[model samples]
Target: MEVAMRKKIRRIITILGTTAMIFTVTACGNRMDTMQPAASYVADFFDIPDTVTGIERLLLKDDMAYLCCLEEDGTSYLAAMDIDDGKFLKQNLDLDASVSLLDFGFAPDNSNWAVCLEKAGGYSLRKFDNSGSQVQSVDLAGVMDSPVISAVGRDLFLSIDMEGNICVAAKGGNTLVYLFDNNGRFLFSLDYEGNLMTTTTTAEGKIGICATSSDRMNYDLLTVDMETQDWSKDKICLGATAGLYGGVNKDFYRFDSSVLYGYAAGAQEGIPVFNWSDMGLGTSEVQLGECTDGRFVVLTASSNQTEVLSYEMAVLTEGVDERELLSMVSLTATPGLVQAVSDFNKTNDRYKVELTEYFPYAQNVSNEEWDNAILNLNTRIISGDMPDILDMSNLSVQIYQSKGLLEDLYPYMENDPEIRTEDYFENVFEAISLDGKLPYLTDGVAISTMLAGADVVDGNNGWTIQDLEKVLDTYGANSINNLSGASFLKIMLQTDGSFIDWNLGKCSFDSPEFVKMLEFAGKIQESSQDGCGGTEMSDTYAEAYEEVLSV
Candidate 1:
């Protein structure tokens, strides 16, 4: 029996906005060249690496950073990197010869061709196996590199080019986005959109965010699909637009729950905290009255007894109930090359609770019980009444993705191909099997790993403010989402956007317009600029053009 080549590469497409480019693939005898790893490649610029011999191009991918090398048999292989420890792992593929590529990308699972590259040479596409071997082939003539490749899913690629852009040659291809290349050339684009997005640029492939603008613009955010060249318009507000003085988009002044929050590193006494994300103009429990990066002052009614807490949109990764990752490092011991890992991670706390479990109720349950139990189960799951892990032997827990319950475990799988490729037994790893003969039961439960809280957390009983001081006072340690020090993330916690319906992916941020109502109370803080906001900001008259007249 012949051994199958590993890491097979099928097609490679080059994508980018180029000054000029060309794709020229010629059919000649394979140019047998030894492949070695190049020290480095352009992260964004066209810079080359130094001091390397065994690979053609170095590929830095989303799941794993890898170096491309050639096997003795002429197939390509990728040397993987361990992000936690920063070590190189060499993965090889089986092939006879005749595979050369300029650009490529490793998918989340370290598998090849989660994307296609737009190259300057003939159809610059490369496909590889898990072991880093070429498994497939696609040849096209006169290709250019002005292309964008986005693979938010498996086996699908969205590639956009400046030109000779990716044209849908076959049927079932017309349904994609298209665009004109830079310098006024028409090109085809494709649809491959996802709720979440990220980009990359490399010889294995590259992606960039490009836009055109005028001196005076009305709407500024333009989203161009690299694969389709299709575009969408957005106002592009980085959350709250609190003018220049401490807004969400700005650095220090972060808004949370429409309240302006700040840290006082300089003040000799105490500090005041407010929902910085909401930067209202007044002094209220839910409003940000007076705050500063270095000075915070809290003002409250003498009648109030309860202290208001900085509310979080969701339970944080470091909440009281969340598990913490233990550190294994030692101070006195001579540090070994190998690093020890701890399981007690306390940071997996960012959860809307209900939204994650509700969507899968139908998929994991059978049709006989799908409808009847789905709603109840979803409600139970979101309500936090369910166990951390669910028994799915008789239950069918399909990996429903439309809702944000699942984390596209693809990235984790890409980092560990062998772990995700095999059948998941009971949601647990096959190698880490629990019982016998139960592939379904062998899988790891989502609840077991995630610190999923009770669903009631997202309900209308959101947050109640009794005393205004807990949230606004400079002394309060637990800000929204359990922030201790000055944190930008606290702002993400302070909005109606923070509370979400896990089942439907519904969030409260831009909702029932009550969020604006909450904002109504908040504008009191930012707009004040008075003594109430803080002593520093207390009505200070700027020196007029004619200062002598003031005397």
Candidate 2:
């Protein structure tokens, strides 16, 4: 039944016109001036199908690009596109309810490919020829019998080497790399210490796995020869922390920010092959696959002004020009800021905002990865290599201000004729001011409010601590709705900002007024524990409101 449904889904073939944009990045002598446009490479952009919801993996086989795409109906299929003509073909594979597609890769010969699937009992490996026909299916439960497989969870990596040998790797508690022959026969498994960073297969049929030391300060690349069945480990120094982009012959690509670096199998250093910054492209969520012809296939998904995500496919070849880059760094990409930067670049020719996100959107971000990224950002700031603009949404602005790393924005606002002090809310500026100086500006503000019956406070819209105390005394604490200690404290903190004095760098938490508020909250908590507080209005308030209505 599953195979029949897969065959049914493969009956449809739709041809749509693809959108393409040719962009160039040029290099100038030994120094690449980011502000000036120089000659480098050309980029061709294409539109992905609207029905394709997500791309699990992208592979380039000769002139064709294959993508394992998930559709809106929650089914997975393979879509092939002719790179030159922009023609697309969709074919669904035999995936049932009991199994899920984990990862897929193509053989070096471009004549066949394979997918790794996770099932209830264990895992399965399915192989298919270039024509999309199944050639072999092997159950990997017995083959992957090591206890490390169960300990590593399910973060799996699959690839096919030059000699059509299959390699699968799992990373978590430890790193395990398994090698298998093309005939679905198990060969050998290599174990390595530390966390696995990435894995790649070179043209010489050698599988390379990069892992970080326990301290995370050192990196090592383990290379395994499929035929010889011998492996070697060597320390390597990379230009920047990067993820592997697979291998094209002897050279493999590593992606960091908007730059793509190419390195030989055993080389310590990699040279930049493509820089999306040179073409004024935002690197928010990008996936790259290298072609055999020295070109690249890039898949990028970005949110528009309406907050709708759109995907684009681009081909990067040798020839384009650079643009003036205004660099910006942030922990994650915010939709509004990304849209604003894209709009500014479209309208202005002199400058473009290059936003670099340390932690892009992911299902799960390990605590170690988050901490390392934060440390990296702090190191850059301390070394005076920070970007032109820093998104302080996820950062501590007060700490930066204390260190005198932030600049005062009040002077600039005062000199600008368009921005008048009277035009905006004065309190908004006062709220964030540090030491009587405005260091940052916000686009909008959120107001926290509490709603009450006008008759309860005699039509008064404002209330002080004395007024609150009088009301509580008159109606009893249970007359309020679910005003427990935790709720009361939350409301006070949200509605009041007087606790922290930004200008003086002090907090009034120890003051008598704050102490009194805490005591009042504690009384409410005790009442709640005694069964006097609830979600609904108490009988006292209900009876009083009924009497008023009768009058």
Candidate 3:
């Protein structure tokens, strides 16, 4: 039945919506005086077909763009496009039910290609040598139970390192990666814990698998040693796999969120040495074009269209020069804070900081009205509308950190003569460190502790959040009324399950721990028949909310 379905779907069917962009990076010599445009148009008004309801997967290989789409009738189609001239190629296939393209990569011989297709409950390997013809096909249903098949998404990934070996990563059963040669022969499979985000090859013949967890809270970069079948894993501090782009050189350059991380790709120990950092705030959330000759193009999506941006990047050998005049810009919703900075600017001659008010709508608006205002602020920041030295209160540290936007302040603190790290409390300092390095500065600290009645919960005895939950689970809904919002929030803050990490700049507020906190709070609200009987704490927290709650 499966082979019949595959034959039935593998026809010359072009089911619409195919678009492509060809991006090339250019290397330029230093004149530094000529202004460089951050981005420019490679192509415009280019899009998929009108009939295509949704895009299931997008892949770029050998300057060609392949997209899998699902029609309104629940059927799937694979479309190909020429990235150079926005030309639609003559290859489209109707995919069987529950079958979709996972990933595609160049075969070892460079003359053929392989595509990973997921069927109802299995996978298949398809080879195309004519660029429009499938030369061979094989079913992977039995192998789908292997640990390498345990991925979390419908999309699979195929990549080749410098040595021309192939890597296929999938995410449904258990996020696993399989190694192979150019001949469609399986090498071996390895158990990978996270969603396969990207695969990189070093200057040598090393394959790097970059994967992340479902919640975007954990990440791993693994390198496989083929001959010995040895693999090593490196934990990535960045939380989400979103907005990550990079290519290999002498090292692998990864652009995550807003920062560029240079990982020494040739390490045998699997841990890539952090070489350099790029503070290109302008590159935030922009999809990188192909890396060529030290220049690259970026595509940014807005509204219903795509905008292109170009850049001239310096490679590892480029020299640097110090600037005389330093200018910084910031966007903020707080007027008083802006005015304070303006006052300082008036007195200082060495530096001039310009502040732009982000949300005028935030003024004279209720708390409910500020929701969209905050979203707007986030959109602007991600679009490279950033100011140096941003205030974190209005911005998301996790989002920025995941993008490599926020600078690690530990090095800065060490160099500054006047700033003493010891001045801050230990826990407060630790709170701001994600990977054990200070990425941001906090003005003060907020503490969370439990507040429960002697009759409601057992002896305090330094009861943790887990203990409180266990007690609640043992009792009925009546116990929830005794807990307040402040108390619940405090418990989350104190709990190890609070997934927000400032250093990494990622937060899983929707994590199980946070959900439990909200569920408890919801029970309290739900049990209040009149919604007026629950005790509410509404006073200025002079000392600490945790201290007050505990008392």
Best by lDDT: 2
Query: Tens digit of lDDT per residue, candidate 2, span 394-424?
Result: 4556677777777778887889988898887
lDDT of 3 at 485: 52
What is every candidate's alpha-carbon RMSD to the true fold? 28.8, 13.3, 19.7
Candidate 2 contains a number of clashing pairs equal to 14
C-alpha-based local distance difference test score of model 1: 0.26
TM-score of 2: 0.60
- Over 1-551, each residue of candidate 1 has an lDDT whose tens digit, in order, gives 43332121111111110010111111111111112112111111111122222242333334333544434333444455442234456556443335333334444344464123233322334446665666654432222222222221111222222222322211121123333332223455434322111122211222322111231111122235455445533213222112112111122222222223232322212122322111112212211111112222221111112532221111001112232211111111110101001001111233211101221110122243435545565454455443322323223222222222223333445598466555433222332221222122221122101011243223322233222222334323221221111121222242222266545655566664545444533532432222112112111221000101100
lDDT of 2 at 96: 68
Give the runs in model 2 whose Cα sits over 4 Å from its true position: 1-42, 92-99, 118-122, 146-154, 196-198, 203-205, 216-220, 227-230, 235-242, 273-285, 304-310, 322-350, 354-440, 443-551
Between candidates 1 and 2, which one is better according to lDDT? Answer: 2
State which candidate has the highest TM-score: 2
What TM-score do all the candidates reach, one by one?
Answer: 0.21, 0.60, 0.44
TM-score rank order: 2, 3, 1
- Full-model lDDT for every candidate: 0.26, 0.60, 0.46
